[model samples]
Target: MSKPPLIFAVVVVIIAVLATQRYMQKRRQDAVNDASPVRTLQAEVSAKREFPAPNRRSRQREVIAAEEMRYEVYFRPLSGGAEMMFALPEKTYHDMDKGMRGELSVQGTRFVDFRPDAAK
Candidate 1:
C-alpha cells in the first residue's frame, strides 16, 4: 500500500514480464530451426586464411585472447551451381587445401557436420 512497496512490486512484475518474453522468443526460434530441414552438399575448400584476433593487451593488465581461424570455400551442390563462398572455423576446418573436396551439412548459419573428400 505504501509508495516504496508499490514501486518494488511494479519492478518485480516488469522483470517477470521480460523473462517470460525472452523464454517465448527462444522457444519460437527453436521451433523454427527444427522445422527447417538440414541440407548437405559436395563442397571444396577453395581458400583458407588465418586471422589473428584483435589484441587488447594493456600494460596495466595481462590478458589472453582466444585464437580464431576462418576459411572460404567453394561449395558445389550435388545438384550443381556456381561455387558459393563462405567462412568457417579453422579448428573444425581441418586439412584445408585448395580443391580439398568434402561434404558439408549445414543448418542456418551453423555448420552441422563436414567430411573430407578422402572419407568419401
Candidate 2:
C-alpha cells in the first residue's frame, strides 16, 4: 500500500480501539452507578393495629373488610394517595395484628410509581 494509505489505516485502527475502550469504560461506570443504593421515603400508620395481608395474590381482586379488623402499617409511598404495606410474606393475621412499628427502604422506581400491594 502507498505510505499515506497505510498511515490513514493505522489512524483509523487507533481511533476504533480508543472508541471501544471509552465505550467499555462508560459501561463499567454505568453498572457501578446502577448498583449504588437509591434513596426512598418512609411513613407509618399509627391509628391501625396491623396491616392485613390478603389470602389471595393482589392480581386477583379480594375484598378486605374494614369491620373484621385492621392493623398498624409502616409503608413506603405508592401511586396516588395509596401506599404499600411492608410485612413478612410468611406472616399470619395474628402475627400482623401484634401492633408494632417497622422500617423499610425502597429503590429504583419512583415512590409514586409503586402499587398499593408492591412489597416483596
Candidate 3:
C-alpha cells in the first residue's frame, strides 16, 4: 500500500522474472547441447579463470554465508576460430593451464573434455 513496500514488491517481482528467464534459457541450451554431436578438435587452453563465491553480508555488514567457487576454462581451436569458455568442475579446472594444446571435446556450448597433448 505504501510507496516503499510497493517499490520493494516490484523489485522482487522483476528479479524473480529475470531469474526464471535465465533458468529457462539455460534449460533450453542444455537440451540443444544434448542433441548436438560431440566434436573433438585440436585446441589450446588459452586462459583460465576462477570466481570465488561472494560472502553474504548481514544488515550490519558482517559475513553471513559463502558459496562454492566457480571455474571456467577458455579454449582456442588450434586451426583458428573464436575462443570459447566453459565452466568446469573444480578438479578438472585445476588440472588445466593456459597454452596447453590438445583435443577439446565439446557439444554445442557445453564442454565435454580436454585431453592435453602427451608431448606437451
Q: Lowest lDDT 10-mer window, candidate 2?
A: 108-117
Give lDDT tens digits, candidate 1, residues 1-120: 646778889999999999999999888877776777897888766666555544455333333464443455556565666656556667665656666777888775445777877644
RMSD of 3: 4.1
Worst 10 residues of 3 by lDDT: 57-66
Best by lDDT: 3
**Against the correct fold, how does model 2 do in TM-score?**
0.30
Cα distance off (Å), candidate 1, residue 108: 2.1
For all candidates in order, the CA lDDT equals: 0.66, 0.46, 0.87
Model 3 residue 112 distance off true place after TM-score fit, in angstroms: 0.4
Q: What does candidate 2's lDDT look like per residue over 21-120, in tens digits?
A: 9999888876765676765443433322444444443544444564223433445333234555533333332343222333334443212211222345
Q: Pick the candidate with the highest TM-score.
A: 3
Candidate 1 structure, TM-score to reference: 0.48
Off by over 4 Å in 2: 1-4, 39-120
Query: Residue 13 deviation, candidate 2, in Å?
Result: 0.6
TM-score of each: 0.48, 0.30, 0.76
**Under the 3 Å rule for N, CA and C atoms, how many clashes does model 1 have?**
0
Report the C-alpha lDDT of model 3 over 29-78, residue by residue, as the tens digit: 99999999999999999999887645464234333345467798899998
